[model samples]
Target: MSKKDYYDILGVSRDASDDDIKKAYRKRAHQHHPDKAGGEEAKFKEVNEAYQVLSHKEKRKQYDAYGHAFEGAGGGAPGGGASSGFQWDFSGGGFNGGEGFSDIFGDFFGFGGRGARRKTNQGEDIQASLTIELEDSAFGREKEISLKRVIACDRCNGSGAEPKSETISCTHCSGTGEVRKQFRTPFGTMAQNTTCTECHGRGKVPKHKCATCGGNGIKHATDTFTVKIPSGIETGEAFGVAGKGNAAPFGGTVGNLYVSVSIAKHPVFTRQGDDLHMKVSVGISQAVFGDKVEVQTLHGAINLKIPAGIQSGTIIRVEGKGMPRRAGYGKGDLLAVVNIHTPTKLTRRQKELLEELKKENL
Candidate 1:
């Protein structure tokens, strides 16, 4: 049986440019990517085979000259090598099992399976606590905090090399920063790649090492940062600052600094969610007849109006006086509970008047 035409399989004209062919292959690969749902693995492989031949100028020229017959000489077609008994093998490449060929395609299409890529040596993240007053939480404030953490060496400038020192490429790995070792196993010889020990994968070595940080590229020191604590931030909530944590040893990215908020307890008011709760004591006359009382809020002291015939434990709401909302504009309501304080002892004249008024039902 004959094979399908490469142009017909890719749905492109015979004279399509290299860029057009690449675009067509990319579109088809996205549609039939095996990682996606309802993707056709067989069709995906077929498209790859077609692209592998058509994308190369020399291979495309050979295919145009000899068609599928040229694949046998190039070791591409499956059955084309049946006479010679040679077949396509993936064991030589690392894409045989884990991560598979999708990793290579993923690098191009921004997908997953990036096993062949080098792992980044990122610095560890750091934790810090910030103590702020309740009033500061109600209103946002900026605070400067001193922290002790790993920072890049100022003398060496993170290069771990002395000033005016010359850096030379590593002789062991030939500046590739990797060393390959072959082991003779029962099955066969297996080769493994590892970071060069002589240069520690830096690909270069300095003639003179830095004396300040001792060629470590980093040091422990104190740092000061002015962080803004947003309004309505509660206890245990954290604020993150990018690239402000520990410095990486090499050229890697610096980690993040997480600042946890610890709001101090208020002396007069208790907070619940976004609302403020407080108790105000009023005399018997103030409860029977309306009177204005002073209440302490985070912003300032405000007079709360008490209604006539108010009973003890009556809750009065003062809108927009509590803590500010976390996400939206406006403040929560302040709930004030009235506590009526009755006099323990009364004067002789007050007792006589109360007795007469009670008898009169006034």
Candidate 2:
């Protein structure tokens, strides 16, 4: 019986280039692979046989010159006399022509022996920013935040298919998540392994796709979560909450949610590490003599004593009154910087008293 034409089997033109021939053969191989649903073993074998003859440079030349006559006569091994219709040899009995089909397809598709491993379906992580009052950071607080992100479909539960739908092995890649394809480029016919587009590399096809997610198994949704703000957490720092990010599409692990924190600027105090610094103004009389004053802290107002003969730019400390320390023990002290307020406008009695004092001192 006459063998099928190699070019016709691959659905390519008679003058197809070596790369084009390989590409055509690759698509046919996946389409007819017996491992896939509705696969045709005979057609898959025919495709491989056609590629075997047309893929090699010397074999293609012979096939082009002598047509099926070269293969019909069994040709000569790999290398022999030109007139013998065999221009090349299998080198070292490599192509014994029995059980070499697997190796040949393996080499053509980069399957090594069987094939590459199936891909994982882990979800992607998401990031968001949270702003809080400085007091919230000074003393630990819990905050509830809402965010819009991609979440698993509640109807299908991230499966991508509707309930009661039957899943079958993929027909496009024969249940392989990856498909081996050949393409014609400027360089030459190059073979590549790509994720199967039909099933999105899931190796299975759903009879009915989920209507809500459109077979993506996810949807945009708003979710609420409560986050703990640890004391002493500075701005630009981030914390992670497990399984709070975008949900995986096909039953994979859920990703994490990263929350970046920012503290709003405070009007009364400036924070450095765990310490709070503030400026306090006193009258000249209060500075000259001892006085007691109230200062603001993160918690509440506290009394601070001013010693006699205090000068401007003097820093007074109120122990255990500042922000709480994150680790170890004691709270930071509140630093009060004193500035003596000189009278801008003096009354006549004050002017007279100052003049008399100055004269006595002189």
Candidate 3:
């Protein structure tokens, strides 16, 4: 296969800037998102690949300098020969084959349509962005979400018929929903069966249809449900609320609702996985001479002792001071990185002491 021009794939100029490439990718991804029509996963993935390469300055430079020859050489799709940074090993020692690739990019092209489209008949899983305070994530919380969506029509009660209506078998297919014919030939006999597309195999037609749901049993309705978010949950992880998505059309199955968490950004502390990060800024003298200081955490302000001669970027860990494990098991460590503040403007005598101290290091 010929290598496609990255710029052409992303519909950008060869000389486009990183931001331009990013903008193009965002536009294209949104257009091809599975939620929208014609959003084939394959096309979307190609666009992603184009953007991934062009948006990175170093990667772009390498590609421009080497071309597709970079495949095994590490310039194209992350490859392998025992050197690919990508995970190449199979877990469970079984054939995962294309499962991993399809999991992320198969739906990129609408070519992967059967499962993706039938998923519509199955109803789509809906995701809601939920923001909770940091404390809420540490200790679980229950949230009630209210929304409206199309469900089975309720007027006909999914029967697709009027209250006084009667059903009759389809004459065309003789209630079989299919028509069969025998064609006698010189050699022998030939038989063929054809399904009646009109009745769609139901074989019955209603005399009158329900007005409210237009003969369908379900209806569009506002639904409300409370979901419990587990404690120690990390942002971006999802929780499932069963039978909460839009009702399937034509009496199909209801979709599931997946609520993705977005933890409110903290003002004082930052979290990485189970661990917490705190940048404790200290006075230059306090850092050099060591002293006890108070710091804020998700729980509360706690006293932390600093060792003498603490340097910027130095890390001090407080065991079990961080967040709890997501599974409610072991606790994480709170790591404090140091930042020493030097007085910008000091008294004449203060300046003299600092200058003398600098001379010692010098």
Give the residue spans of candidate 1 off by over 4 A: 1-121, 171-173, 179-202, 345-362
> Which 10-residue window of candidate 3 scores lowest in summed lDDT?
82-91
Kindly list the per-residue Cα lDDT of model 1 for residues 153-259, writing each as its tens digit: 99988777787888888788998777875433221233445567656677886668788887657789899988878889999999888888998664456788999
Q: Best to worst by TM-score, what's the order?
A: 1, 2, 3
Q: What is residue 70's positional error in candidate 2, in angstroms?
A: 50
Is candidate 2 or 3 superior in TM-score? 2
**lDDT (10s digit) by residue, model 2, range 168-254:** 888899998768754432212334455677776789977788887877688889998788887778889888888888787765677
- The local distance difference test score of each candidate is 0.72, 0.72, 0.65
Quote model 2's TM-score: 0.59
TM-score of 3: 0.49
Is 1 or 3 the stronger prediction by TM-score? 1
- Candidate 1 colliding pairs: none
**Each model's TM-score?**
0.60, 0.59, 0.49
For residues 198-306, write the lDDT of model 3, one tens digit per residue: 3445676565656776544457778777878787788888888777776754455778888888899998679898888889989977987999999987767889999
Between candidates 2 and 3, the one scoring higher on lDDT is 2
